[model samples]
Target: MRSILPFALALLALPAASAQQQPYTPPKHTAPPPPGIARSTPEEVAQQADGGTQIERDRPATYALAEHRRLTRALGTLLPQRKGVVDAYVLSIALDSDPVFGREAREAGKVLARRYDAVGRTITLGGSDGKAPSPLPMGSPANLEAALARIAEVMDEQEDVLVLYTTSHGAPFGVVYNDGNEGFGAISPRRLAALLRAHRIERRLLIISACYSGVFVPPLSGPQSAVFSAAASDRSSFGCAAENDWTFFGDALVNRALRKPQPLEAAVTAAIAEIATWETRGKLKPSLPQQSIGVEVQAWLKPLEARMPKVATAPVGKPSVDSLQAP
Candidate 1:
């Protein structure tokens, strides 16, 4: 009987061991290899040295989720259009097919507009007609002005204005339109802010999704408004797909929205966290997003308060929405 008891315990240990050895899941990243950097994983190292690395692979951005959390705790929800003193906004999707930002830019406007009803909505021009090469089209020298005029009519009698923008790439000066010609395209943040100021439009916000977009914050930041840009000043972000769909920032933003609806500030924070967290499986970084400028953002600023998001305060200067940590 004693010998049988020992054997029975050994059998039980074997099942537990097998369960523990089921399988190991590894993390992944999709960053590009810098200059001449040549490094590979242990498994790949042997394959390259012995058999040479295989070429059957997709781009790095095609990676899967890295980590997931589980807890009994749970939570929830909610940009808009303004008119007149505060009218509806002009959601500008600059889809320049030649530069490859059509579908993606348009989608970005749609996403934010649908999610945040407190700001201007998006209005895309071109791309479906295979006009992908041009950046800003038809919006004109008076593009923003014209768009605002239409917004004024939309809001007709409302009292807050907002502008959400998306495009492929840009520099410090302004946004590129669908028009191949760079004829004074894209409304500068400084000018846009000044325009808002002119109206005495109590509340406003601008969401800029493009390369080198950190420029949005400094020019547009104020006590009564906020600006959120997708990338830093000198970095390239993902998403140059055929249809010109969303990039890493877009995907991340959508994912965050799915996890839990939040105020502009919260949603932006969570998305930044998602990309900044790194992994070996993929080489993508959470975009270094920017937020409100130097001034502290008050949660309750009265009527306009409801217009601009109750976002966290970003330090003044470049890249506004950065997370400020306490020492």
Candidate 2:
């Protein structure tokens, strides 16, 4: 009887051990729908929040038309009946909804327009003080698309170059497109590449001034493009707070380097050095501004450089690293 009892106990333990070795399978349950709300599928939720739908359905028509008209006028100013050697189009996007980005973007646009001889051709898109009619429109996906389309209408894709300088907060995903009280969404690297391709604008210079902007280079870089980013893919940029006049990169690149008589490539190189010094002084992790210049872009940019204005640059000064910390 004792032997039989021991064998029976071992047999019972075998089932328990097998159960312990088995993979976990969570129990599934179908709960009743809420008393009044209807159940929604994942697809339905996504469609409701789709970027295009959010703008069209949520944005008021009157405001939309007013913004559209403003952009049309701005673009009209730049459409030279005869295309120049390089018809530069500057799009300065302030995606963070902060006045600092807005101000910096506007100033950068002016600088690029002056340097590239694109005074009337440059389009500035962002919010501004209520005192004046806002330039272009608030930074949104729709506005960005419209601005690109307008440029395409006037620009000779084969001969002219597009210089797009965007400044704002960014993530690993891409540049952030926010309108403060309006709404916000990310412009993923893939999506931005698609937008540029859709326009069929081949020769391009893209400067992304934002945190983690290096993520844009891999996806957007091509033989006909020169991509510059404010930080490496894993790093954050500085001087993005609401009170500052410019981000660390924007100030160095646009306010300082590009304002001089130097070529775009030289300006980019100088900006890199300036950024490194600022980061070191702040005792912050290096942003490591990145530049990916395609072989073809150098040839494309030569004519534009020939036409660029030679301006006297003020002596470059060190940014107050303490005030330029990332917020």
Candidate 3:
């Protein structure tokens, strides 16, 4: 699995310039999409006269977009529940220039972390404060670098990590970074994959919520890793929501999907389908949702499927490191 990680994880010496932080490139082939793609359909414009989903409307083109949004929420409530120590790093840098929605994303991370599992193990997440001074200046790159570094450090110091999630926006060709072309912004997929290998993280799982995130899978998806995204490489993701504030994909995963009782992949796939349908009904071109794994997560589950050991119950302040065991 390590041999197949992306370039970012391949060369992990730099604090911020790892392979994931590839140089910026303005996509020349693809032209800008129409502006209405960003417009809000709202109530009257919704496919349903009720201006909601799960309910039907008999209006013109407007009514078709009114979905109730009950889809992924059901799945979130059904995703398989687990217990483990998670070193979460939520980086929200909405200050970036390219219409970033980091602040809301950070909040989504917290929402997922709370119900993600509080007992049976400990979870240490950095960037919970919303803003962490990362290697990248203040964009997608910053979020990615902070996330990768946290994972590397945790693996080097701890063991048996369950998941790693990075949520942010991305340009067609790359993730946003610190400068218009510097440390901050989004990191590349290959570079991110390399970070996982360089840190020697085993059995890692990644969930990336971003627009055009499909571009990342080719380079970052791993044999031992499981990944989920908000939008395909060719489509623009919906964000800038009033409440979620980030992308709808992130909201579905953290707020809705995490609340479910299914396994990780099942929950994610359901969320992808729900979001795609919601967008399509709303007059927006449907974005493709994909689940591509180098190695099926299910393949590695059989050996450890029997039963996990209970976590040590030593007193909180007097915790004993020697008693630590994989749960």
Candidate 4:
């Protein structure tokens, strides 16, 4: 009976052992390779249409030469031989890629020059190509440096006040300097402060129109300077689209408020109010434009203010697409 039971258990164990010894094998079937296309390097790909490698263009040198000539001429015009109580030197720079900024900056410069009787003394730096009749040269950093040097050369460092109005796209880092075709870098607050200090431009009325332009106020402000920014450091301003004629800040501050025969402080206050209304109507965040007038700068600005040409105040209107139409 024991032998019979052992034999039955051994039969079951033998079947298990035989299954473990022989591993399962899958059927061999190869997959077809993916459809192949001709491989080519970037240069070769670019040349496929022409059947030859495209030659790199060397137009930068030519552009540089032309820009240099224009800069020299523009700088020559900004120099005033005789020094006045307030030789208002307007430097209107459009540092954005949008064409609207270029147009707005040029127009604002023209208006400021007329108001201050600084037609020849004004130096405008815009983003337009040299083919057009522009008041100033390109708005590049090098060109700005040269223009500042020219101002220093002509301006009385101690008495004269420099009215610099820069319109651009701004960031937390700094004000952007962009040419539509050729890319440029930003102008940091520190760098701008250094540029002004280097030129000994102590007495200044600096108006910055951009998003987060309040970042410029601290670095640029001093006892002899009046800094006005379009927006708070943490906020963004409105009406800076490519199609718009003027930024919300620019239109409110320059086109509407400053255009009136009023004090600079009063104009800024009025502009702020107008900007608030515009933002409310558009359902946008408030920019909260900033202004810092140093104690010494106020007295200096008074005499300059008196000399400004009295102009009729135009009715303030809401920004519209039709405003983009060329005059």
Using lDDT, give the best candidate's number: 2
Superior by lDDT: candidate 2 or candidate 4: 2
Q: Could you estimate the TM-score for every candidate?
A: 0.52, 0.77, 0.52, 0.76
RMSD of 4: 25.3
| Candidate topping TM-score | 2
Candidate 4, residues 182-286, lDDT tens digits: the string is 444567677788889988898998999999899889999999999999999999987877767788888888887777788888888999998888788777788
Residue-level error in angstroms, candidate 4, position 113: 1.5
- Give model 4's TM-score versus the native structure: 0.76
Give the winner by lDDT: 3 or 4: 4
Candidate 1: list runs displaced more than 4 Å.
1-90, 98-100, 118-122, 129-141, 153-158, 178-186, 241-243, 254-260, 277-287, 293-327
Which lDDT tens digits does candidate 3 get at residues 148-264? 454344332232444555554555544433222221223556556656666675565566666677777766666766666666888777653322334566555555555455555
Model 3 poorest 10 in a row by lDDT = 314-323
How many clashes (backbone N, Cα, C below 3 Å) per candidate? 47, 1, 56, 0
Evaluate all candidate structures by whole-model CA lDDT and list the values in order. Answer: 0.45, 0.74, 0.43, 0.73
